[model samples]
Target: MNVETTVADSSLLRQRAFVAFWLARTCSSFGFQMFSVAVSWQIYSLTNSALALGMIGLMQFLPSVLLALPAGHLADQFDRRRIVICAQLIEWGALLALVLLTLFSWTDKTALWGLVFVLAVAKALEGPAMTSMLPSLVPPAILARATAANAVGGEAAVIVGPTLGGFLYVAGPDVVYSVSAAFYLLSLVLIGRIRYTRPQQPRLPASLSTLFAGIHFIRARKDVLGVISLDLFAVLLGGATALLPIFAKDILHTGPWGLGMLRGAPSIGALLVGLWLSRNKLEKNVGMIMFGSVAGFGVATLIFALSSQLWLSLLALAALGGFDMVSMVIRGSLVQLDTPDDMRGRVNAVNAIFINTSNQLGEFESGVLAAFMGAVPAAVLGGVGTLVVVGVWMVLFPHLRRRQKLENEAAQE
Candidate 1:
């Protein structure tokens, strides 16, 4: 089979709207990581409870689960750009409120919870709009590269944001919050420059029956369901990131900077891999790569849990991130390629919900288990559980591997 290496002559990176959106997302992602670190650190410092930190994750997830479907409907009905702008403004407002609370010496646990709640609300509304708009900016042929580039932008933020946040937190949490607010404001301005026309849809029923369409759409597609479930389980079981603060301060004796490294290491790995994949095409056997990468992620997590040395742990985390990015690129490209234009909003909303649910549920699980078995033991067990889930998934969905080679062959043909 002969494949056209250049499916389209348009350079995705050269597109102005894509560039603006990518830069805006990158900046916002950095701010997002800082906000996450600040909230977790503040809550843990005040209460010294893993449960409290987990509650922060739970608060964020609650709103997303409740609003995601409706938000997706809105994304389908309205101008996505407008939706994104409004969400960014709301997030900016939340950051400002946190900044004020900290500056006025009202940095109590209750105040922190209020801020977390508000940020969660903002993020919940933002998720669907931001995700649904991606396909409009880049052509279909280069969607994988665009996705990889977007992942790189996000991972770069993850790498920089935590390290910067930790240093600023050491100096003063107020400064970190202030900087975060500034980043959101910058994102709002940058988003203003993007000029893509959103797809129009006919008026549809606004009932519960209609709202459940996205779920039904995904349920009927075995491949979609399998991939989504695969991600859900692996992330839910293996993710112990919410407990990093506890491990860094109590177990590792590294403090905030060390905690930042633990947080940023994976993103560093992800960034490198994302950049590499963006240039090279994954034209064949992508499914095997995805499975292997996730298995590697589990192994890295297990290693990180057992290691006491900061550098060793960071190395393990970097490997985890690198592997995870491979899966991300493969899954993301598949989602974009398979979903119809009309269904993109709802499908992507479901995807966002799955991702957030997995992360939040993982956090809750980690927090609860850490309360009983200690963080190290809980994390290690979670990693092993993830590997088990992978094996089970492979047994259940042998088609995923087969489809990888099939898709590549089809593309080449």
Candidate 2:
């Protein structure tokens, strides 16, 4: 196929609105990455307490749990575009607060932490609404590909953010926050520039049942529940990333920079795979692919857990990222396309919780297990648990197993 023709045919590249949103996603994600590093370092530098650094994660996580359901309801019942923009503005204000906090050389870190909490709340509201807004930007035919393109950008940002943030931090917290603020500003402008093609829909009043509707919807759909839960349990069990610093220092005999590289390895792997998926379409046996990819992730993590050599460990992490990317693309596409427009926000909010559980809670789980058992053994156990999850998911959710091609299946329906 001609490259130009292919580029021209791609909705993500060809549509100005999508391109703008894609750029906005890139900018905001990048800013968040940089902002997290700046905040963590600032907190540590100020308080000189590891516990203070740990609270950053907790502060960020609480809102995802508390506000997620309500935010999802808001997304469904209001303009998703406006919801995202407004949420972003809230984040921007938080960034501005950080800029001022650092610029003035304030001694009190609690105020800074408070602002971080505000950023957390802003991000919580942003996730569901912004994610649900994408389907409205493109046709059903292009949604899967769009999802792939998105994964590519997101994974890349995940890989780049910390490195960029750490590098910028050397200039001073003021410099780091300032640069991050610029990213947020650009993201806001790009999102604002998009010609809002999405039509407004009638929404339901906010109620207890309305908030619970997303949970009920997922529980009713075995395939959606299976996909979401499988990702949740598998990653929650298999996540070994939190122990990487220990591996770098104690096991591998590598330095702090080595820890950084190890921290980025999985995202780098996912980014490479995501780029490939963006170009090639997944048109056959998607469910099987998802299962196989997740199993591959388990095997890779197992290898990483057991390996002593740095090279082998890095390779295993890469494989883990690659496999997880495949699973992410399939699940993300399915979640967006399978649900109705009115319900997408609620569904995405539930999905966001699963994602947070797998990542944040998974980190907590890994740390706990490592404290009891050795880090190596804890990781090995997680890897084993992941394989077991894939096995169990296959037997339990045959509908997901039989799912051949997502887009084609939609066409058939």
Candidate 3:
């Protein structure tokens, strides 16, 4: 270990703008997680249909596919901070509407889905601007740490938000919505206080070229393309979490509580690893480390697919999460550092689309595969497929595989 580089204090906490951004992100992420849980429960109660629950996901995903590119263009052409603020305001209003609708018993499944769709639209607009703003908050030297820290906040929210929402739902769905709205309001205040200076650049006219510029730019940079596509395929193929309900019931022979634990295990593992990465930098052979992490993820998933015991399966899932965190930190830092400041928004917008597509489609892919084969075989196939992807990516993007050091890549450019 390099002692000089291993200093746990990366000083990110001392940067006021970065701190504000971090806290604001954490608050909003918590709100979204809690909101998702409450909305699902309420929708199920109202409609009493599993298809209704799936519809909610479709409602949330459609905007990412449809709006992300245009939203990215807006991020590059306009004030990123202002865009984020406006997006959060829209989310806050939607949450407030949910509270009122639930309080008055005016809420129906359709109304719930519509409001959720509105929130998703706001998120689609906010993601690119918010992501592109991170490079400005901290020095380039510690961006990997900053990205890891950001993941820590998000993972923490994922682990706790649903349980908190579930507990608050015992009071009423309105109570949960009210708390979630409060969290969003807090996020709005924090983000509003952040200071940023948008560079002077000629505003380009809206056109097919301007809208698709992010995609074009990404295609020109092999390293960035490799990192982004690697993540897309890794999660796309390694989506074993989608089959947790199946594992909890028939395979693991456990109940709802067991399923909850199984669901939370990966987040717990990711959180722990994220915390570690936030403190320590990957100072050498970062590309190789990233590839290794993905490979480790595949191995963990395979272990999970084969395990019948709940304990062993949980361990495998946790390992999978930890390896994923390592790769996520590397991939996120690489993409941000390699992209120029002027095009960061558009590039990140493209990145967001890939992420959203992978997540939504990964679940769909898992379900279809599981239906054709048994859950174990499908999950086993996913795990093995992830390994194959890593091998092929290494061969396809040789420069990315041989790269060393996170910051050095940007310097060489």
| lDDT agreement with native, every candidate | 0.82, 0.86, 0.92
**TM-score for predicted model 2 compared with the true structure:** 0.93
Q: Quote each prediction's TM-score.
A: 0.83, 0.93, 0.95
Better of 2 and 3 by lDDT: 3
Question: Stretches of candidate 3 above 4 Å error?
Answer: 1-14, 408-413
Compared with the true structure, what per-residue lDDT tens digits does model 1 show for residues 1-413? Answer: 23444543334433878889888898899899999989899889889998898788677778888888888777777788888899889888988888888788788877788778877787777777787788888876677888899999887787678879989998778889889989998899989888868556786867786677778877876667777888999998887887899889887899877986787788889998999988888777777777888889899999989998888888998899898898888888777676666777778888888998888788889899999999999999989998898788778777675665313233211
Name the better of 1 and 3 by lDDT.
Answer: 3
Poorest 10 consecutive residues by lDDT, candidate 2: 404-413
List, residue by residue over 1-413, the lDDT tens digit for candidate 3.
67655553445333878989999999999999999999999999998999999999899889988999989898898899999999999999999999999999999999999999999999999999999999987888899999999999999999999989999999999999899999999999998888777687789988999999999999989899999999999889989999999999999999999999999999999999999999998889998999999999999999999999999999999999999999999999999988888889889999999998998888889999999999999999999999999999999998898899887454333
* Model 3: lowest-lDDT 10 consecutive positions: 5-14
Which scores better on lDDT, 1 or 2?
Answer: 2
- How many pairs collide in each candidate, listed in order? 0, 0, 0
Order candidates by lDDT, high to low: 3, 2, 1
Candidate 2 lDDT over 179-205, as tens digits, reads 888888999898888766455677778
